[model samples]
Target: MRFPKILLIPVLTLLITACQTGYHLTNQGYSRVQVDSLAASADSGMARFLQPYNQQLGQTMNEVLVESAVPLNKARPESALNNLLADAMLQYGQQKLGQPVDCSHLNYGGIRTNLPQGPIRIGNIYEVMPFDNQLTLLTLKGSMLREFFEYFIGNQAEENALIVGGVRVTIKNNLLTSIEFTNGKTFDPNQNYTVLVSDYIANRGGGTAFLKDAVRRQDFPVTIRDVFIDYFRQLGKSGKPINPTTDGRITIQ
Candidate 1:
C-alpha cells in the first residue's frame, strides 16, 4: 500500500544544565552554553575519548527514521496501530518461513502505546512495542481458525480481540456471521494454514485451548518488536509513512 507524503521536521532539542551538582537558579534571565566546536583541532582529546562509545552506540536505536501520518492506537475490535503491528508481523513471519501467512493473532494488551503522527524514532518503537515476545509460526487447520474466531466472539465483553490481519470477519451481535481471507476465499476446513502468533499466547494457548493443537510450531530468533521496527525502517527507505486506515476487515454490525 502507498503511504502519505514524507515530511522532515527538526528534532526537538532539550536544554541541558552542566552543573556538577543540582543548583537552583537565582536569576530568571536566559543563559546560553557552548555545545560544539570547543576544541580547535579536528582530532580533539574529547572527541577521541568519546569516539569509541559513540561508534558502539551506532545508528540502530537513536536514529530518527520512519514517519507516521496519523496516530494509531488500539481501540476495540480493530485499530490502525493494531492492524499495522499485526500486518508487520504477518509479513515478516511469512518471509522468514517462505510461505503465505493466513493470519496473525496478537493480544491488544500487547500494544503498549499509540503510534503518533510524526518522525518515527527507534526510541518510539522501544516505547510502543516494549516486549521481548518471540514470533512463532504454527500450522492450524481451517476449522481451528474458525474455532479461534468463535472463542473471541463468545467472550467479546471481557477480553481484547486478537489484533489480526490477512482475514476479514463480520461480527453481528457478537456472532461471527461472515469470515474470509483477504483474498476473498472462504477458509477451507480441511486445509492447514500457516499462522503467526506471539510466544506469549501460543505457549499458554489463546482465549481458548484450540491454539495448543496447532501443528508444526516453529520459533523464530528475532523478537516481534524487531519485526515491527525493521518493517518501519524498510518503509522509511521507500518514503512510506505510517498511514494505515480501517479496512473494515473486522466489521461490527
Candidate 2:
C-alpha cells in the first residue's frame, strides 16, 4: 500500500497507540450497596436459582447440637473450651483407634473462636475449628512425651500454645514441677503413650517440633471439628450441656 508522509505518520501513531495497557486507578474507592429493603428486585431470577443451596446451608448451619452452659474461651494455662475440645479429641481417638488415648493436644491457635454460653450449632463448631486438620493418633515414647511437655511449657507460654487432655502439668516459677495424668497417674519417661493430636501439629504446621520423633502415628478419617460435632451430639443425647471445667490440668504457681 502506498501512502503520503502525513498519512504514514498518522498510521504509525495509531499502530503505536493500539498497544494494550492496564488501567491503574489512583483514586480507587469502594461502592456500597444496600441489599436489604431495596426498591428493586435486583435479579430475582438468579436469586431463585440460588435459593435451594441457601436453604440447605442455612438449615445445616442453624441446627442446634447442644447448649454451652459456660463460655468456652481460650486461655493460657488452661480453658474450659480447651478442656472440652481436648476431651472430645481423646474420647473420639480412643473409640476410633480402639486404643487407650493417654493424652491429646489441641493447638491454641487452631481454635479460631469461642463457644458462647448458649445453644451450640453446627456453624459454631465450624467457626471455632475452621481447618481441615484430621485427627492423628501418635504413639510416642515417654521421652517424646517429656519433650512435648517441655516444648509446650517453654514455647506456648504466651497463647498457651497447647491445651492438653489426659495429662496434668503443674508449673512452679514457670518450670514443670509435676507431670501426671488427669486421673492421677504419674508420667513415665521410659514408657510409650498413645495420644491424640491434630494432623496440623503432626505435619509441622504450628511449631510442633516435639512431635517429629513420634514412634508410630495413625491418621483418622475425620477432622477435629467432626469429633467435636459427634461428641456434642452424644452429650446432647444424654442431656449433658457442653460445659467443661478447668480442673487444674495446667496449674500455675
Candidate 3:
C-alpha cells in the first residue's frame, strides 16, 4: 500500500469525499499539479465539508483493538516491542505460507512508535507501522544466513538494528559469536532455512544487498500492519492481553 507522498493528498481527498457523498472513487484520469505552488491557507469551504468525515475517520482509528500487559518500547539489541512484532511476523508468515518459518526479522526503522501499557488502539498500530510493507519469505542456505547475520551485526547502530524472532544471537566485540534457534538447535551451515521478512528487505532495500541472494523468494499479499491488526483482534476476542518481554534473543557483550 505504498503511495507516492505527493499523491497522498489527492487520494485521501477522494476517500473522504467518497465517504461523505456516497460516490465511489474511480480512476477517471490524472493531471499534474504544482503542490509547492499551492496557497498555504486552508480553504474554509473545504474544511467545513471535510470536518465530519475527519471526525468519523478519527473515531475509527481510535477504536481499541486490544490491551497490553506492559508498555512496549523499541530499542537496539532487543526490546519488548521488537519481540512482539517479530513474533507476530513469524506466526503470521507460518500461517499464511502454510509452512514453518525458521525465523523473522524487521528493520528497526520500520517501527515508528511505542505501545502503551493499557488498551491498544487501531491508531496506535497505524502509528507504529505507517508504511504498508508486505511480508516476504526467503529461503537461504545456512552459509548465506550466517553471512546475513554477520552483516547485520557489523552494521548495528542505535537506530539501525534488526528485530529478530525464533533465534538467539550472541555478539562479542561487535562480532557474531554464535546464533542458534530458540529450540536449542545450533546453526548449521549446510542447512536450508526459511526466513520471514518485509518485501523491502527482500528487494534489497535498506542496504541489505545480500538478501537478493536468497535461494527462493515468496511475496505475500498481506501487509505487516494487517498482520499486527489481526493478531491484536484475536487476542482481544480471546480476552488475552499481550505481555511481550525482551529476552536474550539478541545479546551484545
**Separate clash counts for every candidate:** 0, 0, 0
In Å, residue 32's CA in model 3 sits off its true spot by 25
Error of 2 at 224 (Å): 0.6
User: Candidates' lDDT values, in order?
Assistant: 0.76, 0.81, 0.84
lDDT tens digits, residue span 41-139, model 3? 678999999999999999989888898888889987789888888988888877766867899888888899999999999999999999989998999
lDDT of 1 at 63: 81
Least accurate stretch of 10 residues (summed lDDT) in model 2? 153-162
* Residue pairs with clashing backbones, model 3: none
Ranking by lDDT: 3, 2, 1
lDDT (10s digit) by residue, model 1, range 1-253: 6434452222212123333457797877766765665633366787889988887676656786688888767788787887888888888877765766788877776778887788888878888879899988878887887777667666656665757888888887777777788755667888888778888877864455667788678887789888888888888896767677888778888
Which candidate number maximizes lDDT? 3
Candidate 2 regions off by >4 Å? 1-43, 157-160, 182-185, 240-243
- The most accurate candidate by TM-score is 2
Candidates arranged by TM-score, highest first: 2, 3, 1
Candidate 2's residue-wise lDDT over 153-232, tens digit each? 77764564558889888876556777787655667888888878888888876577667778998887788998999988
Off by over 4 Å in 3: 1-44, 183-186
